[model samples]
Target: GVGAGGDMPNWMTFLISDVPLYLIAMPVAVVLMGKSTVIETRKFNMKPGMFFKLLLMCLPMMWVGSMVGSMLSLALSDGEATNRVADLAMQTNIWNVVFLVILGPIFEEWMFRKQLIDHTRKYGEKTAILLSGLAFGLFHMNLFQFFYAFLLGVMFGYIYMRTSKLRYSTAMHMIINFNGGVLAPWILTRVDLDQLDKVSQAAENGNVAAMEQWASQNATGLAIMLVYFLLYGAVILAGFVLLIRNFRKAEFYIAPEELPRGVRAKTVYGNVGMVTFIVLTVLLTAISLFL
Candidate 1:
């Protein structure tokens, strides 16, 4: 989901709605039949100091990614990008920024990285981790985003794997998203609304070259951004190396198929609910782009 509506916190909205539905359903059949299952946080076996180290390392990487992405969004996504579709975006809603930067990472990390990925990888180890990252990336529709999301997913996945703690990667993700999704909007709000109009005009007219020229004219801000990128990327790279060097290997968690048969359905759904969820996810995602 693209998150909830109104001035209410998206998480609160989900807690009031989706969480209840999912929890009540329990995917009992899946748990019972044992095809595959979500991660049980209580089962996590973390090594000492891993959580602290991961948090220390990821904080900077997340900052760098966020800053760079925001700068790029402002720089490259000016008027001509997205085919003059900027008007359709939720520029006025600060929640857009919050959701993209904060809420989004938290939920995805909780769902894909912490739940699905964790479940698979805990059982199969690195192979499972890789598959989880792949699934996480591909789950985002369209080719343009696949490559970027995939790479980011791998980085976060590896960190999650190394730490065996959700907190570290979740922090990392939130930081990375905060700049573009949150901070940028905050900054933009302070700027004269005329700039948004200017941006919209440039896009609506398909004047990409003008947008580029405008960015060049504001080279000071852009240069500050470039420096930020280099510094942050460097730190994240080092943290990644450190995580790898510190792994204490353990046996993978057993998959559902190996568990006892259940009285519940093999999955949360037969074929019907499964298709419906996927369809709804895609439809909502498209609708989000419009918002």
Candidate 2:
């Protein structure tokens, strides 16, 4: 049976509720994209240092995009969409882990980064990257993640264009997801939220001594929690600094024949397929933010 009362398993539930579009749309994307398209975008090899350089460059942009999304979530909504991740975390199982950290990245990279790039790269690389980013961001179906996903979509598309390999993008995606899903959750378990609540209560009651006592007792846990956040912040800061310092030095390849900006935009995204996807995602995002 799928569940105690014959309900679907958590993984199935997640797949159905979260990503049914990917399941349905990918086949249509495939039929729409014939075999020759895949061949033209075949993955290529790159030097080891190049991969790290790209990672360092792109990771900071992703962080900035996420921060922007967070601000937008705070301003435009009650963060209900972003907060849903906590609810999802409660239902964690092997399948969720597999899908989140492994299968999900692979499949998404293939569809959004790989297929989209292949489908549009012939027209213009920059246009392809922009379109891929838009699709990827909108695919998240919420304002809380749209900015970051879109930025990452562009970065992933660029990486694919540079290396021509799905593995590079997939590995980067897995690394980010693992840190967010696995490492972050593990760190949370090490922190004592109940104790913090108690401390808050004591302070509210004007019990400074009790608050101090609780803090002293839980000093080690507090230190660990503080250090964990500090470490993450430091890494993001360093990555941002490095990315900015190297921005102009980063490589850009020339397209075969550059289209006018308007023509390029239309060539990549002004079609039934692109418009339908954009409208669907925009509607869903609006619902998530407003409803």
Candidate 3:
């Protein structure tokens, strides 16, 4: 049932594809890497205020990355870019919500933040964060998602590095996915785009009657959309301010078995697998923009 046409339900598709990758492939890979890669479990505890501040501080990066990605996609596709991920996100349902808002964060954090970081932290904390973030972004294999995913990945990676707790990063990831994959889509669905387009045309042609008719008919939807955008804009602005205030306070520590500064790049990228992954993902991302 899982085909190119996306005939299968979202949960079923996730089970077939994502479940296997998380449960089987990643575990197998970790086991092959040996006992040294095991992540030490730690209690998850972050002050509510700290969590809120961290979230706000990272929002600007998310906003900027999203803008860049969207602009690049538009340019590459000559303004005809189609985001299949956004299309899927718009198909709001309980199953989709559960997967996107809950299960996704659990599995993804365990894989990318917990597993990948555990194995790579020996190189250096910064290196581990960057590696996990870059890999996470590239793994999406979509031009529209790469930038923001990478930015958020780094934020989550830092949280996990500092706390050594999956729960912290997992919770943050959940909130983000909930916003993008659930709440935003729901808000968008409340508005009728076709009618909005008609209303816009009417306004452009100075058709007062038609424009007023739309305003009256879709008052509730308009209000909902207006509130959503206003709140979103506020969050972005707060995040930008927080980022500027906290930029100097950010910290990184020397990692165990840290690589030398001069050879860190070589140690990380001069590998057969990493090179192959970067090249292939870049190609796929580029191809996705065209598609």
| Best candidate, lDDT | 3
Model 1 deviation from the true structure expressed as Cα RMSD, one decimal place: 9.2
Off by over 4 Å in 1: 1-34, 37-93, 184-291
The local distance difference test score of model 2 is: 0.72
Question: Which candidate order results from sorting by lDDT in descending order?
Answer: 3, 2, 1
Measured with C-alpha atoms, the lDDT of residue 241 in candidate 1 is: 71
In candidate 1, what are the lDDT values of residues 54-167, reduced to their tens digit? Answer: 545554444444355335434553522231112212343554455555656776776656665655553444555655555554455322233445556766777676566777
- Return model 3's CA RMSD, one decimal: 2.7
Best by TM-score: 3
* TM-score head-to-head 1 vs 2, winner: 2
| Model 3: pairs clashing at backbone N, Cα or C within 3 Å | none
Q: Residue by residue across 1-291, what tens digits does model 3's lDDT show?
A: 011125666667656656766678678756854665553545567898999989887778888988888888888889998776777777788866677778778878887898888888887999989999998888777778789989999999999988888887888788888888888988887877778898798889998888788778878888998999999899989999988888788788876688998998888877776788789878978777776
lDDT of 1 at 173: 71
Q: What ranges in model 3 sit over 4 Å off?
A: 1-17, 35-44, 203-206
What tens digits encode model 2's per-residue C-alpha lDDT throughout 165-272?
889989888888777666667666665667878878889999888778877877787787788889877777777877778767746665655567767777666778
Location of the lowest summed lDDT over 10 successive residues in candidate 2: 1-10
